[model samples]
Target: MNYLKEYNELTAICPKTYIKYSEPMENHTFIQTGGIADIYIKPKHINDVQKIIRYAKMNEIPLTVLGFGTNVIIRDKGIRGIVMNLEYLNDITVNENEIIAGCGASIIDVSRTALKHSLSGLEFACGIPGSVGGALVMNAGAYGGEISYVLKNAKAITLSGDILVLNESEFEFGYRKSIFQKENYIILEATFQLINSDPAEIREKMDTFTALREEKQPLEYPSCGSVFKRPPNHFAGKLISDSGLQGTRVGGAEVSKKHAGFIVNVNHATSTDYLMLIQHVKETVKQNFDINLETEVKIIGEE
Candidate 1:
């Protein structure tokens, strides 16, 4: 494609710090079920990200940002445009009882850092399989704690190429949603406020949460963590379980027996298979419970 040619030319002129022409979305996502991206770029620094965004905007080329890919599903037809990966932006620093983390930094890393510093609030994120940026954008949560509770502020690049810092209130975080969902902003970093606690106690809390996840989740399979958002006053998993959709399969994708909330790639599932399963689950739940199940996982690219 001409776009691929343009992407190559641009990467050739860019600094060596960034890597260009990566691979399939499956390689990056937790579910391992997506097609290839035409042109994948990994920006080593924040400036590199800005430059790439400018280039794409100037040329009217499509651009998509990928974090750790824990909560996203790229389509089987593959992504047509530049896929910007911020994996190299991973950086974390702790001051007092707060943490400053780059968007690319893993949530697991942030939680471990908090544990090292005896910070208590982030223990709930230790088991979450996402990067800081993805968590912030989705307001990712587990075990009753969420990003909005601890996030102080965030730095993001606007679609028009302006960098802005927004406080937690400005993001308007609510139940697996954030302002980033509405605005085409690229998150750069976030700061979080934590609480002082004993190191041993923090470790114990993290361990308990991790153990709970291990016992309850299908950690053995490749899958997006939670397929559906929790419906009002009710759990998505309970609804699916009540609908008799547990262990349901479409191709190699199946509703996880261990956790009804997850749709796992049990045996080399294609992206189409996974998506079909997701649709079936949603339809079944709606038909049986009369509650519409919204997806927590972001679906991207074409069919």
Candidate 2:
């Protein structure tokens, strides 16, 4: 494929935007194990985002949108066509008890910003390692707090270049889902409604959560945060740990002894190795407990 020519055409339309051809998905993903993306883009402005979408639509190119790559896995054959990463669009601002943040802004950073402003609602997000956009899409939460609880509204651009502002009710938030997953809308920004609190109290809560994450999770390795979603009345980690699947290895990928919920890349683990280990864990857990395990991580691209 003459990806350079396509890159040239894309560059012509989305001028000054950073674009690359045959970019390695491993470098962009948190797991660091995937093939190449045909074209990778980082748009600096919302205008560029609109232009890229229009170009991709007109050319019939497959467009894959990526956040900060914290909780996703890209397959070995990589993603074809254009992959847009909303990294440079990050910007955060605070107004009294409300926070207005770009979709690309780090959720962790946003939480910190809340603490700095003495906001209490985002303390649950203190340890989340995803973009605000991705967190909202999946309704990411921990320690009894979810994005849906604090979200006011969100700004999104449709595939047809139409802008829409959706309120909290329209999000359809659930355990780990929102309308964004089913709709072809590109999230632009989000507004959060928070409560004013003592900076000391917020910091104490943030510190506690951070300490707990470090103690319980395998923070010293490369892996998607948590591999499986919690079952109806059972915890995925407890099931895997009880099934004696900890420290199990598939190639360089291993189920972390520290947290059975996480599959870590202890060595040069490929996407295949990671995936195979996940399957093994699921099957073993299902066989032992008669419960099916669904993944929390978003797996994309080709096989």
Candidate 3:
């Protein structure tokens, strides 16, 4: 694919935006793995995003949206076509009993904004190291709460460049799934309804959750967070631990000893190492427990 030609044409059409060719995906991902993106572009505004999507669709070029890169693994051969990053769209606002956040805004930043305004429901997302777009797409949750519980509505761009607003019901949010995933919608911003509470109380709850995550998770290393989704009536971690796969290494990647649910880069792990370790864990767990563990982390790009 001649991504350079597409990028050149795209730049000629939208010169105000930042565009790069053959940008390293390693720097964009939380795991610090992967190869390069054929074309990486950061749209400064919603209009810019719309134009890019329209252009990609019109030219039949593949387009991928990247958030904060918390819950995905890009392959070693990199991504093709255009990689649209929403990092520049980090705008947020808090009104009474509601919070509005752009796609690029960090979930932690949203949680902090909510806390500052004494909003209670967002306390669960205080430590989720993903962007609003990623959180909405996955219905991301933690500490017994989820985005579906608090989400009021979301604005998204359809594959054809038409903008649409979807309510909670329209989003069809389930555990680790949403309509955004099914329909290939690009999330723009989300509005969440939260309860009014005392700032001190909200901060205390967020602090507690943050502390617990730090104590339990292998946050010390680069990782794609939880590698597998929770199996029916059982946690993925317990399954891996029961299979004696804790601390198992494939190249520089290891099943985290601290949290068997996570596969962390203990050293300088490549994307290949991570993929191999993930496959090994899935196969081992399935053989031992007769449970086909599904990955919660999104794998993208090329091998």
lDDT of 1: 0.87
TM-score, cand. 2? 0.98
lDDT of each: 0.87, 0.92, 0.93
lDDT ranking from best to worst? Answer: 3, 2, 1
What are the per-residue Cα lDDT tens digits for candidate 3 across 120-211? 89999999999999999999999999999999999999989999999866988888999999999999999999999999999888999999
Tens-place lDDT per residue, model 1, 145-166, is 9999999999999766789999
Which tens-of-lDDT digit does each residue in 150-249 have in candidate 2?
9999999988777899997799889998898879678999999999999999999989999999999999999899999999999999999999999999
Instruction: Tell me each candidate's TM-score.
Output: 0.96, 0.98, 0.98
The lDDT, on a scale of 0 to 1, for candidate 3 is 0.93
lDDT of 3 at 240: 96
Question: How high is the lDDT of residue 253 in model 1?
Answer: 94
Runs of candidate 1 with Cα error greater than 4 angstroms are none
